[model samples]
Every structure is written in C-alpha cells, then in structure tokens.
Target: MTATALPRLCVVIPCFNEAANVAPMVARLDATLAGIAWEAIFVDDDSPDGTSVAVRAIAVQDSRIRCLKRIGRRGLASACIEGMLATSAPYLAVIDGDLQHDETLLPRMLEALEGGLAEIVIGSRNIEGGDKQGGLTAARQMISDTGAALANAALPMRVSDPMSGFFALPRDLLEEIAPRLTGTGFKILLDILLSAKRPLRSLEIPYSFRARVAGESKLDAAVLLEFAGLLADKALGGVVPLRFLSFAAVGAIGLLVHLAVLGLLHGLGGVGFNAAQWSATLIAMTVNFLLNNRITYRDRRLRGPALLRGLVLFYLVCGLGAAANIGIANLLLRDGVLAWGLAGAAGAALTVVWNYAVSATLVWRAK
Candidate 1:
C-alpha cells in the first residue's frame, strides 16, 4: 500500500457468551459503515453459549465477520489483542459484542481518524449529549466517576471518560505498547495511556451506552477489584516502587493499631514487655496481606501453592524492608532533639521504596 493510501480499519468486538446479540449487533455495525472499507472481528473468549459458532456462520455468508476462539477463559482486553494481532488493518476499533457500546459511533471515530484530528478516538458518555442506557446505579456510577477523576488527576493527560471500553486507535500504536501490557484486565485504556511514548491526542464522540441485550452482565465484584488495581497501576506511573505507597499506607494504619496496643498493654495492664509490639505487628501483617491480595495485586493471578509461595517471599522482602526502615530511623536518631519526628518520616520514606521494589519483582512477578 502507498504511504498516502488510507489503510484498512478493522472493528473488533470482544464477546463472552454473547450469542444472542451477535446477529443484530453485526447488522447494526454494518449499517453504520456503509461506505467505509472495514471488517468486524468477533473474538470469542471460549464462550460456551455458541457465540463463536454464530459468528462463524455470519463469516461464511459475509467474509467480514471473523471469529477467534481463545484457549482459556480470556477477558475483553485479551480478546482485543487477539483481534488486532490477527488482522493487518492499520486502524482497530473496539465495541462490545453485547450491543451495549454503540456501534453507530464507528463512523464518527473513522471521520476523526481521516481528518487527522486524533490518533485515538473515544466514545464518551461524559459530554453534554452523551448518555447511558438503563442508567448506571448510583453506587456504580459514583465508583466509575470517582475512578476516572482520580486517574485524570494522577496523570498528566486529561480525558473526560477514561473507563469507557469503546474506543479506536491505530494498530501500529498498539503494537508499540504491546510489550508493556502484562496484567490481564479490562482497562486497555490505562494500558495504552501508560505505554504511549509520544503525546496522545484523543477525540470524544457523544453516545449512549446501552444495556446488554443477551448475556448476563460480567461486571461483577471481581471485575471491579481488578479495575481498581489497573487504575492504581496507572496512577503510580507503572513503577513497582509506587506500590510501596500502598504498603506504606497499610503500615501507617498498622502503626495506629500498634500505638493502641501499646497503650492497652502499658496503661491498662501495667505491662512493660514487648509483647504489645509483637502482637500489633502480627495483626498488621495479616491485614496488609489481605488488602494486598484483594486490592493491590488483585490482577497478579497467584493462587493455591503459588499464593503461599508469594506470601513467603513477601515476608522475606518485608524483613529486608524493616531493616532499611531501621537504618533510616537510626540515621534520624543520631540528629537528637527532633530525632523521633524525623525518624518516623525517614522510616516511612525508606520502607516505601524498599517494599515496592521487592514486591513488584518477587511477590507479583507473574504479572
């Protein structure tokens, strides 16, 4: 193809158990792209609901509908990656197979690409004309809005809607950042934003997101937890040491519990022994472990024996972290008068770095 020639654009719909919506979804997508040189790829994540079979039938009649079946229980982001890799199209678009994401916005995205307005185009529900179908529940909407706000605040780039799954960008742009994408999660936007080397220009099209017509919605508790972790990863600049902030936050809370235990032991029980410190450490360690599993490293996928191994490695790392904390504490103590105050700050700063480096390299190495 000549450099001036407009390259092919492929639309990818990632579906899991979306068999019932595939036919109508494809029809709607076709209606929107009447004049565009485009093809629709339905990447099925080994759906048991015959989603792949239905798409295959569609493909037989219309060669534009391609289906890819994943080996294991894959997610939306992984499915999108599979579709992009299979096609030679320079531009790739993502929409929901369940018909929740508006396929009618495809033309607007294509128009923006052709106009050289944006490298990536997003369908936003945050704009004035944008809307959501079956309105989001207050709690769900709040969580989404809060997450987006926090992400925009944390990053240098500003996006009106960062959580929306419907968006389009060039295949070459995605290929450049493929190596940095490790964790299997739903937030491909975060993946792209974090891995993007050059400045990213974005366009937002106002559109309403509809409720799924066929399958049960997969937005469960586990997905939300993974979503939070992805947001945190981006917020921390994708550096492992940033996770130490999470560990430090846990440690700070533990210090509170430790002070209370110390008071209870000495003031009420009249005991001067170190038992209080030891007990508080045990309680805090347990709390940190639970939080790390459910929140900090939720997408790491360490389970059973692998999880136990990770825990052991975590403790070893923490031991080294504690030593670093002590070293900083001693340095401050040498300064006298304001020693305790400075020591506390020094210990926190030192441990944060130490913990993040070790945890990212060892405990959550799989991701």
Candidate 2:
C-alpha cells in the first residue's frame, strides 16, 4: 500500500541568540511535521552562539532542514522575511526560536488551512485548551492584552488572538503584503490584515506556550515601545477615529484652552473683550487644530499649498461648527450638563466629518 501525498508546508523559524533553544525546537518541529511535506528553514539573525552551526549539522542528516546565516545582525521580522522568500512552498508557517510558540499545533494549523476554514491559522493562547508558560508574568499578560485590545479597536476584523507570532499563511498572501510590511517587529498579523486584498478567515488552535528549553527570552522595553508605536500607527489609520464621543473629548480640551486664554487676557492681561475673544479663539483654534491633526484627522495627509488652503477652510468650518455647538449646548444646558456635553459633541462630530472630507480631498489627499 502506498502512502497518500501530503500538502507542501514550509515552517520558517526566526532565531536570534537562541542557540540553546534552536536545536531542540528544530528537532521538535521536525518530529511534529513529519507526516506533512514539510521543510524547516531556520533563519538565524547572526547569533553570537553557534546556532547556525547546530542547524547546519542537523541539516546534513535531514534533507528537510536548512539554515540561513545572516552575517549582519538582522531582526526577527527581517529573518522571517528572508525565510519566507527562500522557501518554495504554497503554505508557509512562522514560529519563534524561543519555543514559547508550540510546534505541536503545527499539524492542526495546517489542517485548518487545508480545510479552507482559514487563510491564516494562528496557534493562539487565548483559545480554549491553550495556556501560557511560567514566564508570562501578570504585568506582561496585561500589557499583551491591552495591546491586543487596542489593535482590535483600530482594525475592522477581530482575530481572537492578534499577538500570536506562531501562525500559518498562504505564500500568495504573504507575497502580496510583503511590500507594505512595516518595520514594526513581531506584529506581522497587523501587516497582513492592513495589506491583504482578500478577507482572512482565522482559526484559534489550542496550545500551551512552553518555556525556552535552552536560551533566554528576548522581549525588552524597546520591543514594547515599538509595539506601542505600532498600535498608535494603527489607530491613526482611521481604524476607530476616537469614535463620536472622542470629538466631544477634544471639544472639552478646546474649551479649557479657550477659557484659560480668555481669563488670562481679561482678568490678568486686562485686554478688551472683542480683542480678547479673537485672541482666545485663535489660541483655542490652534489647540483644536493640533488635537484633531494628531487624533481625529491623523490618517489624512497634509502637504503643499493645499495644506494652507485646508487650514483656512477648517477655521471657516469651525465658525459654523461653533455656532451649532453653542446653540445645541445652550438648549441642552437648560436640561443638564451631560446633555449639553452630548449636544456639543454632536456638533464637533459633524465638524470632524467636514474636516475629513476637505483634508482628504485638498490637504493630505490620501485616497
């Protein structure tokens, strides 16, 4: 009896200073993926230790194993990119050298992809029957959870676990997104989501996050900062644009800026009311402009003469916006502070829409 043909699978492991864990992790993966038409490519990021040497030794015995030694110290993201480019398989998988990501989930992940249940199958700790290792401290878990939440808040699609580095994706999709993949390390999931032309189905497989059998974990403060920056970038990409209530929050800040300027000019500066009004309004306008530019209209581009034109139009729109805000605020203020706040918020939201259109068409002009 002849054995049935298996699907072609390429497991790309990104290794950085993981000599101790790399060999064992490679062996485990080889054993795990034995049934499939699998090739394990270990892309080493110039580890000081002899990780490449060990992988090379193993590759001599096993035709399925190959090692890529980048003499220049490349990062995890780049290593993955290099491995993906080198492999010749329709289905590709990414895993960490740390061994925190389970190799046991590889078959099931491939199964999910083969069944057409998901274009990308993630081995998720958040899923049922999945567990994190001892290294995952309370603070670390919270930080990870918060990051995932923020990412979901910005993206249109919600994956139960977006932070998982261990995932399988089709080579075609990877090639499509390869051009736009940001330097934001480790969060390739976001890169895929933002760049993929087709909708992605996801599978949350159960697996335990294991301890590194040999080397230390590489996560650091700098990596966390990079992650936070990625989250901020995602937010600025019109993901959830602070929502309707966020406009009100900006208005409230604007009010504080306005009142503070007004009081300084009138009470202490002793400037006349009309002159003070213009001064205070101008200061408030600057504050609002900065806030909206940073938060509400962040994704919109601004350049050239169009930026100046947009600024002029934004202020003009603000005057109409202010009148509407005041009218609604007054009517709602008669009822309550919350109502007045809501009404002012509504007005500010309308103005943001006005700002978005003019900015998109004229200033930044991002299609």
Candidate 3:
C-alpha cells in the first residue's frame, strides 16, 4: 500500500494493560492481511502499563498503526466505538487487545462484507470449526454460555454466540446504528445487533478463541452486571437511560441493606424507631454510593482524593433525600396510613428520583 493510499479495513483493538501483546498483534495482522490495505487502531484506556506508549512506538515505525489513548474514562464498548469512528476505512473489525481473538479472521470477515454475503460477520466460538475451550476457564465458559443463551432470547434473530466480542461490520452499518448503541459494556456486538433498526444480514465464521499471551483477562462479575444493564437498556428501547437503570438497581440493593439494618437495630437491639431509621438510612446511603461508583458510573469512577470528595458530596446529596424519606415514613406511621415496612418502602421509592437526579448531576458528572 502506498503512503497516500487509504485503508480498506480498519481493525479496532480496544485494550488496557496489554503492552506485551502490541507488537505480536501487529505482526500477526501484517502477516495475515498481506494483500489488504488495512490499519490497526489501538484504543487504550490510559493503561497504567503504558500500552499506549507501546502502540505509539510501533506506530512511529509503521504508518498503519495508530494509538487512541483515552483518559479518565474506560469501557471496551466505548473504546471500540471511538476507534471505529476514528477511521475512514470502508470496513471495521473489533478484536481484543489481549490476542484471545483470532486476527486471522479479519480477511474472511472483510470478504463476507465486501462480497455482499453479510452485513455483519461474527467470528464465533460456538460454531462447528470454532473452539472456546482453548481460551476460557470453566467458570468463564459457563458465564459465556449462560449470557449467550439470555442474549439470544432477547435478540431479534437467534445468534449462536451473541456474547462473542470478535466481529466485523461495514463502516456504514456501524454509523447507521452508532446513535442507538449504549456503549456501556463489553458486548459491543450484541449492542450493534440489538440497536439495528432492521435485522441485519449476518454471517458467522469459525475461529479458535486463543489463550492470552499477555495481560490479565478483564472479565469479572461486574462485567456480567454491565451486560445485564446493556440488555435492560436496549429492551426498554432507550426510554430509560442506561445509567439510570444501573442507579435504580443499586438503589434496590440499598433498600435491602436499609431494611436489614433497620431490623437489626430496632427489632433486635431495641433501639428507638426514629434512631434506627436514621442509622439504617445513613448505612444504606454509604453502600449505595460505593456500589454506584463501582458499577453505575464506572466509566467516571472516582479514586483517591476524588473518591473521598465524591463520598462526602454523596452523603450531602442523599442526606436531603433521606430527610424526605424519613419525613414521609414518619407521617405515614403517625397517621396509621400504612404499615411500617410498607411506609419505609414507599419513602425509599420517592427518594430514588431525587437522589438519582441530584447525584448524577453533582457527584458523578463526567470529568
């Protein structure tokens, strides 16, 4: 390819802490995509291990290599979206930076798209020629299988591996559905398929899911929760924002905490009702703030001093929320309008709107 020639394909590798795999991934791409004009964009979420530096080192030597280092924000789906949008390449492929995904499938995926055989091509592990056992642990495999099953149930068309992260699609198709994408989790492929206005013409290619040669696997229990949030976000057709759904889910858990604490303090410890309620409210608010930081606003998660500051702000914000909660519950208790438990639940419910609205704007506002 000449220096002035435009790439026909752009491979977007969303990564963090995968510096060791950088050179090898580029070498693999160079070997496999011999006749193709392609570029590799490594979207690093400001990896502490200097993954961006590694990419830039190679990029200085090779024009086709590029680095997009994101600061103070992170998520695979969002990284891939940003990388894909950074290129003018006609076709876009998303492969992992950990080298678990087969880079060899890029050409095949591109062919399927260019030949009009598919609108989106997925490198599937569940297919006959593919293998997931090669890469995933037993627990991870089970999680993948269960998630695939659940995703397929909700998908417009049944997919053998809706959980597969390795996939490719036309840049135009991506642009078409980009506006609808939640860009919140690991399953960008699922987000793409679900967000499409019309059922996309799809093809699945078989590829062995390779074991990682460098960096730790980013998959965790939290990722599953994010996946669930993604499903909920799409299922509602984006009526309720994704972050709000996560906030509400955390709020539900907080309610459980509040009730448990209330029971322990008031029922078991013989504390006064008002005192127990206040104690439970404060404890629940703390739990909710921590969980919200870890999950709901994960991309904008605060750390160190910021986390401390955010916690203080959260307490102040929810303190007002708690006031409304206690006031309503006390009024109901005094008037005999409802049982204690029901009154408490109603008060908590009313405060969710207030806390979520205020906290989102004040505490977790993007930095």
Candidate 4:
C-alpha cells in the first residue's frame, strides 16, 4: 500500500460492556470520515457482555476497525493508554465508546491537528454552539462542572472543559506525556493537559454530546472518587493508585464489619467465642470481596459462574493472608524485634498487599 493510503489516525474508544454500541459507532465513523485514513480501536476490558466479540466480528471484515481486549486489568483511562500505545498512526483521538461524542467532530479534530492549527483538540460541552442539552442531565452536568473547576485551579494552563474525555492530539505529544499519565480514571484529557511540560495550544470544537441509543452510561459515584484520586495522584507524583486507595478504604470498613459481626454473634446471641470469631472472619472477608468487586474492580467484575468462583478464591486467599498476618505479628513480638503497635501494623500492611495482589491476579482475574 502507498504511504498516502496508510492509516494516519487512530481513534481509541475506551469501552466496557458497550457491545450494543460497537457496530453503530463503526458505521458512524465510516460515514463521517470518508476521505480520512483512519482506524477505530475499541479497547475493551474483557467486557462480560461480549463487547470485544462484537468488535472482533466486525474487524474480521473491515480492516479499519480493530479490537484490543485487555485481560487481568481494567480502567477506562488505562485502556485508552494501552490502545493509543498499540497504534502506529501519527494522530490519535479518544472518544466515548457509547457514541455520545459526535463522530462528525472527529474529522475537524484531525484537521486541526494535521493542519498545524492546534496541538490538542477538545470536544467541549461548555464551548459556544456546544450541545449540552442532550446527553448530560442537570445533576451530571453539575458534577462535571465542579470537577472542571477543581482541575482548572491545579492545571498549569487554563482549559474551559478539562473534564472532557473526548480529545485528540499528535501521537508524538502523547508519547512524550504517556510516561507521566496517571491512567487512573476517566479524565484522560485533563491528565494530558497537566502532564505537559509546557503550555499546549488547545482548540475547542463545539459538538453536541449525543444521547446513547443503547448500553448504560458508565458515570457513577465511583467516577467521582476516581477523579479525586487522579487529582491526588497528580499532586503526589503518582505514589498510589486511586483504586488501591479505594481498596484500602473498603478494608477499613470491613474491619468495622468484622467487629460488628463479632459483637452481634458473641455478645448478643451468646454464641461461643470461637464460633463468633470464625463467623466474623468469614463474614468480613465476604464483605470485603463484595465491596472490592463493586467499587475497586467495577469494570472487570466477574459474572455468573465466574462470580461464584471468584468469591471462593477470594475467601481462600484472604484467609491465608490473615493467617500470615497473625504469624508475622506473633513472630515479631516473640523475637522482640519491635513494639506491639509496629509489629501489628507491619503484619496488617503485608496482609493488605497480599490480599490485593492475589485477589486481582487470581480471584478476579479476567476471562
């Protein structure tokens, strides 16, 4: 194939359970970019709804459409990073997998980047002629606006819509900032803008955010937490992932659940101390697994038989981790290595790391 015919743009759609939107998005892109040499990549986090399957089916016939199924990991922003890194195209764009962002604006974004008019092109809902009436409800818009305000205050350069997920930039610029990206949440455009060493020339293109015809929206309370965590990560130099912070918070709650269950069984019901202890341990483990599945690993949640299997595996891993915790604590105390407080803290810290690693790699591993 001639150089002119080679694909010059890669569109990354970070997706999760967006099977219904795959074909429609591909069709819309094909119709919208008639002369542009572009390829659409659906970066799926091993969606249980067979989203990757749908994209692969289309990819079999259409070379311009591709699927990048990521296993054993999840996160929309991370998926976008992986998708962008997999492409050799000179220009890259990120759009919502639900087809909420107008596909027609993609050509304009490409034109701005390819024509040397801008280094970054954002599809803004706050810009003039931008359609804010369609996709986002009042409450959602408020949340977005609040996030944008917080992001702008910390950003090196001012941007009207830093919360926007839809944006385009040169592959070279992306490569330069890729190492600095937090890849933690949904606001990748903000991460890039903040990661840049110097100011970026940005252009906002007005486009109506279309309502989804199929599939549920991914926005939720967790998104808010993730966004907060991203800000923290950027501020703290990426010392910790927001998901890990969420996991630790859930663990703290599980400790309360353990105490409550133990108190209820042993104190109120007059159950044997041994019986109550075992019951509370098991119950707390169960509670932690459920919460982690829902909050920490929401995108890669196991379903059907996988869910049951994961629960059993989680119990085993956590149970073993608990045993290790006690053993290490006892060893430290008996050896007079440190005070009881430090020993116990070290033991708990080790257990938390062990549980998180095992749970992610073994229990809730992607199919």
Identify the candidate with maximal TM-score.
3
Candidate 1 lDDT, 1-367, residue by residue in tens: 5454343789888888999999998899788888887888898977899899999988999877889887555566777777877888888898878887878888889888878899889988888789853546667777778778876765557788887889998888888887776435776776677567555898888888776557887664555656655666665667753345456666677668767777787668877657766666666665666677655565454689987887788778877887888877887788673468788787867786777767878887743
On TM-score, who's better, 2 or 4?
A: 4
Check candidate 4 and list the clashing pairs. Answer: none
Model 4 accuracy (lDDT, Cα): 0.88
Error of 1 at 350 (Å): 4.9
Give the per-residue lDDT of model 4 (tens digit) for 1-367.
6554658899999999999999989999999999888998999988899999999999999989989998877777889898999899999999999989988998989999999999999999888999887988888988888898998888878788888889999999999999999877688888888888678999998888888788898788678777887888788777776667778888999999999999999999999999999999999988998889888888777778988899999999998999999999999999999799999999999998988888878976655
True-vs-predicted CA distance for residue 180, candidate 2, Å: 1.4
Shift of residue 53 alpha carbon in model 1, Å: 8.6
Q: Which scores better on lDDT, 1 or 2? A: 1
Quote each prediction's TM-score.
0.68, 0.61, 0.92, 0.82
Off by over 4 Å in 2: 1-7, 197-199, 234-367
Best first by TM-score, ranked: 3, 4, 1, 2
lDDT (C-alpha) at residue 173 in model 2: 74
The lowest-lDDT stretch of 10 consecutive residues in candidate 4 is 1-10
Encode model 3's per-residue lDDT on 126-203: one tens digit a residue: 989999899989989888998999888888887888888899999998998999898888999999998997778899
> How much is 35 displaced in model 3, in angstroms?
1.2
Candidate 4 backbone clash number: 0
